[model samples]
Target: MEVKKAIIPVAGLGTRFLPATKSMPKEMLPIIDKPVIHFVVEEALASGIDDIIFVTGRSKRSIEDYFDGSPELEMHLKQHKKHDLLEKVQDIASLADIHYIRQKEPKGLGDAILRAEKHVGDEPFAVLLGDDIVVNEQPCTRQLIDIYQKYGRSTIAVKEVPKEKISSYGIIKGKPLDHSLYVLEDIVEKPDVDKAPSNIGAIGRYVFTPEIFNCIKETSSGVGNEIQLTDGIRNLNRSQKVYGYKFNGTRYDTGDKVEYVKAIINFALNNENMKDNILEYLQDVLASKNNA
Candidate 1:
């Protein structure tokens, strides 16, 4: 089966980013020249996803506008003979067939995904958390999708985190199918370090079957009286095979301040147009710090 649609839950309040996110969606925050969400959307598009369902919230109109056409800007650029820049602006609008719906309340990732039930219908779809940016030789979502196609089961992207950080993410306990794949036996949401099942922490990329919606619907509120997608995936394990693929990639959690800065620096240092200038600037800054 060809997986064609994806759901992006972008409605979080981004409390970690505070005043900067006060009037802006964290996904709208620029990594350098592009918003964080742009990278996510580009990943999805590159991975053969054709339709994007954005589960959004209030004050996120800018997100919609970013992908929508910019007539005035395009006209000004065209008039100024900045054809390259004008085409770039025009390209955003043609990237993918995008649709948006309100998440209504900031429930949880499960609830946010649930909002896409109608749009997703009976097909297998993906859920890409707005804050995770997976940089891989192959797209992270596609990696999971390939696993899904081979095994005919839902798949989640997993990567090892520090043992002490297990409590910060959903930890999976599983038997190894291979060095990089695990047949997930269970998932524990934010367990104490001593009690954690494994160091395999679940990240944001998931390729779920329609049956997942059933699991999500049946799942009751969990900790903090919220619907957790992790809980739903755990429940899905009861009747179906769920696998975790420790994907080949480096993932950046943009929701964290330090990681966000690191991601930008990493990208800038590798970017063709910005590498030399950014490297020289960084060298000077470090030189000054050492002198001080």
Candidate 2:
């Protein structure tokens, strides 16, 4: 079956971003001219997902408004004959058939995902983590969907992170099936470097079968007293085939401040209008620092 629906978990408190995130959602933070959530939703649309289910928190009003049509703004743009800008604003509102429901509490990734059960029904669906921004030739979720279709089972995106950073991510220990695919073995969530199963860290992109909800329900909370999705995947792997694919892409973890700035700079350098100016400005700043 073609994966036409996606569940996006955007209900996190985004505590790391503090004061700026005090009144607005971190997902709404501007990447340049556009917000972070804009890129994420665009990725889903590019991946052939027509239906989107957003698991939202109480404070995420800005998120809802972004996707909602702004009639006054649209009217002003149209009256001013800003045709190009008007099309872009209208496009955001009509991006997809979006539905949202409250998470009500801060549980975990697993719980946020479980909330999408009713909307997703019995078919297999993709789950795209909000803060993971993957710039690739193909959308990350689409890459996972291609693998899921071939294997007829669940597939998770993996990347080889440094051993020192192993504890910060869910590390997987699995046998190699192909150059980029790994057979299911075990996944350890935040294991210390010495005890980590392997260097292959599971990233945020995933295509899961409906059966995964049951596994998540059976999973017990770990680490931060919240139900971790990695634990759910470990439990799911017991009875079914779960594979990991080393996806082709540059993934930016926007949840971290340093990485977020890097993402902004990297994206700006590749942008047509901003590239030359941003690069020259950065070079001048570097030269001044060295001279000082």
Candidate 3:
């Protein structure tokens, strides 16, 4: 079956981004000119996803509004003859068929996904984490979706992190199903470097079958009393085939401060309008610091 729906879990309390995130969602934070979540939605749309289900929370109304039509702003732009700007605003709302469900509590990733069960009924769907932004020639989710079409099994996006950083991610131990695919055997959530199954770590993009809802219900809280998604996928692998794809891309964890700043600089330097000036200014700043 063609994958037409995508679920995005955006209910996390952005504790890492404190004070600033007190009133605003971290996903709304900008990387250059576009918000983090906008990039995520664009990725889903680029992969032919027709419907988007966002598992959101109370303060996330801004997210919904961001993708909705803004009549007053549209009228102002139209009257002022800013045709190009007006078209861009209208295009945002027309991107996809967006739906939202409130995740009442901060249960976990597994629970966040479960909230979308009704909307995604009986079909395979994709899940894209709002914090993990991948920039490449091709969208990251599209890469996973292409793999899903071939195997017709659940697939998780994987990437090689340093062995020392394995404990910070869900580590997987599996055999190669193909060059970029793995027949997942087991997944360890945050294992010590020495004990990690492999350097391949789950990076937040997933294409899962409907059977996951049952596995999630059977899974008990594995770490931090929070129901982990890795546990459910591991259980699903026991009976059904689950594969991991070592996706190709530069992924930025915008949820972290340092990486967020790096993403801003990298994106800014890549922009056609700003690239030359930004590069020259950066070189001057570096030269001044060296002389000082």
Q: After superposition, how far is residue 177 of candidate 1 from its true place, in Å?
A: 0.7
TM-score of 2: 0.97
Tell me the tens digit of each residue's lDDT in model 3 across 1-292: 9999999999999989998999999999999778999999999999889899999999889999999999999999999999999999999999999999999988899999999999999999999998889988888999999989998999999999976678889999999977888999999988889989889999989999999999998999887788889999998999999999999899999998988999999999889999999999999999999999
How do the candidates rank by lDDT, highest first? Answer: 1, 3, 2
lDDT of each: 0.93, 0.92, 0.92
Task: Name the lDDT of candidate 2.
Answer: 0.92
Clash pairs detected, candidate 2: none
Error of 2 at 272 (Å): 1.4
lDDT of 1 by residue, 1-292 (tens): 8889999999999999999999999998889988999999999998899999999999789999999999899999999999999989999999999999999999988999999999999999988998889998799999999999998899999999997678889999999988999998999888889999988999999999999998988988885688999899998999999999999888999999998999999999889999999999999999999999
In model 3, the runs with Cα more than 4 Å from the true position are: none
Cα error, residue 104 of model 2, in Å, equals 0.3
The C-alpha TM-scores of every prediction are 0.97, 0.97, 0.97
Model 2 alpha-carbon drift over 4 Å, by segment: none
Candidate that beats the other on lDDT, 2 or 3, i.e. the better one: 3
User: lDDT by residue for model 2 over 1-292, one digit each (tens)?
Assistant: 9999999999998889998888978888888988888888888999999999999999998899999999999999999999999999999999999999899998999999999898898999999888889999899889999999998999999999977778889999989998999987999889999998889999888999999999999988887898899999999999898999999999988888988999999999999999999999999999999999
